[model samples]
Target: MQMMMAGARTRTTTTMMTTTTTTMMMLRRVWIPVLILMMFGITGGEERTWNTEPAYETQGVNVTVIEGKSAILPCSVHDPTSADNKPVKVVWTDQWSTILTFQDNTIIDDERIHVDHAFAREWNLRINRVKYGDQGIYTCQVNTEPVISYTVHLTVVVAPRLSNDGTGGMLEVMEGSKAELVCNATGIPAPTITWFRKTADMGERRESEFCTGTSIVRRYSSFSQRIGEAGQVLVIHNVTRFCGGIYECVAENGVPPSVRREIQVKVKFMPKISLPSKRISTQKFY
Candidate 1:
């Protein structure tokens, strides 16, 4: 009985030793990597350094400005890692080439182009004296890990302007012939041309007239008549003496300050002679 009890005690001691050895090996396996990471200055209590990339806070926008005026394109970014005091690189480009670039107090040398950075996150591009050619898509880019960009569409408005060459002047036509009067205009949105005719006394009259051969319809008002055809050319078929008058052409668009031009049409015909006493003329010859 004493021998059996001693053998049971020895087995219990062996079991405890094996359990301790297995525990120790498992702890070493778990702590080895942690110790190596600590040696390289990595710790769970430290603040994380990796951050998400910079992103645009606002979507792309459309900007409209009148010609010869200043235009502003807006761009804003939200950078999570900006607090680390790292340099942020910004670039502005168009369809053709790079307009400007900025990084660490560096900027493009352009008098007409300006970068407004009054707000830390806002980067607004300003262009002075914008022309028609400046109207297009402008892109703002940030130099990030993969790079991010925002696009802005610019529209330039131009007022209507009438051309003088072959557009307006004295137009002469023979009686019973066709006459064409042209009014040329140039503008950004393609100005609409309208023709008007003024009467002799400039009095108010209500009448509706229509012409053949291209079909010009005119609605007469008190002072002037609005030609039915809304085109650059005014067509008059079978022109007579009544067709000779002062015609005005107006070019207008949504833009302000419309333009107008006046043209005088002269219809020429042979003079007709009238004799009251046709029989008396024959007795005088005898």
Candidate 2:
């Protein structure tokens, strides 16, 4: 049951005629919606409205997701349920093809990707267990006037893995010059590198014509810190014959299973000449 409140008031309205004629007036009552005052730029509620069209409100933002995680590509619009002129169709796509279609609050199923349209304005696509292959541009389109859509860049980061071509072995340089080595690695968190060198004299000394125990190279420095960073350059400054040894670059990003690359540096130099005393032709006088 509801109750209504009505106020009744009476007012006498008079009008003057040109020929001093009698005036007659009538009373009328009217009601209006108080909430309709703020619509279509109309002011003071004069019972007049302007025609305005609802704008297409589909826009997407870039998203970055880590590997083994999940991500959501957003595609929201205003009054998606209202099919006034054109039925609004929300479709998510990669650079290739359509991923999912949203129609009447229902979406096509693909198991890994699902719709999150709980909020009337939210038309989002969820991707579970994201991987490196999922990194690319994703688009969300609403088949409206002029085709309103949005593009989102999805970046998936994984652990680092060294590539064969990125690792150079048996690198050489001339004496009094500089030596450079490359250690190429691929993965997420894009690995940072540190270089180390193991000398040829690091082996154990044998007494009985053979070595018994194993020798380990435990000393490793963080390199000279002159890494060029494009492929993690390992530099040997002022290369000399003594600088020839095993150079190894280790790449790590706090991810499981760090990658390592090894290179042998051979510093070439001219051999020293030592000759015995030469005998003269005086032997003929004896």
Candidate 3:
């Protein structure tokens, strides 16, 4: 009877032990996955902290442009670190920018703004058209822990135009009045100037304005002549009634269109009276 009782007690203890082990195993299985999921969720939620590295400190760059032309500015980083590795927000400013920001850019409003991918590490500023006032210092700033800034100088050069240099005015002189016909032209290539005169012959004049003649003293008759000279200047020493006509100055650079100026000369003098003034006074009353 004792042995049976002891055997029953042992089975009861074994069953209790088995039950406890099963319960522990079930608890571990259920808690292990739950603990792991919770840990993962907590870690992931904390991972994405709004963080960015400081901008790599650098200096401004230099650029050049011609009047009515284009220009570009480049900004780069040096001695990069985690503080300087993240994408940077860049701002560009110009000392002489009329529009304020270039197109698409906040600095000014025009169609000339251009930004590239490398801007994350290096900033590039591009202008479609540059003007005289556009030449000056430009600044680039990166927003970060320790904001980095850069500067660049821009030079704008304009080529002289024919409109301003090739233009001239007319020269007015009275007929029989001693005068000179001058044609002045200014250009880069030193434009070739020509002067001519239109006579009844319809041919170029044999004598240029510089030639000396007695026509200044003689009574001038009816003669309409067009005087034209081809040179930098055409000078007529003594002008007469015959010389009073259309004077044209032509400037040619072998280009499609040449510049020309026309001057009209009108001769005026007191008409001679048939009867002398002294004879009329001496006759007195008839």
Return the top candidate by TM-score: 1
Stronger candidate by lDDT (2 vs 3): 2
TM-score of 2: 0.44
**Clash count, one per candidate:** 1, 1, 23
Cα miss at 3, model 3 (Å)? 99
lDDT-based ranking, best first? 1, 2, 3
lDDT of 2 at 231: 48
Q: How close is candidate 3 to the true structure, as a TM-score?
A: 0.39
Off by over 4 Å in 3: 1-62, 79-84, 96-107, 117-121, 144-146, 162-286
lDDT value, residue 91 of candidate 1? 67
lDDT of 3 by residue, 30-97 (tens): 66545543432332343323255444455555676655666877766442334434443455666642
Tens-digit lDDT track of model 2 for 186-227: 777878887655443323112211211123335454222222
Which parts of model 1 have CA positions greater than 4 angstroms off? 1-52, 79-81, 97-99, 103-110, 200-222, 272-286
Deviation of model 2 at 179, angstroms: 9.5
Cα misplacement distance, residue 75 of candidate 1 (Å) = 0.7
**Model 2 score (lDDT):** 0.58
- The candidate that wins on lDDT is 1
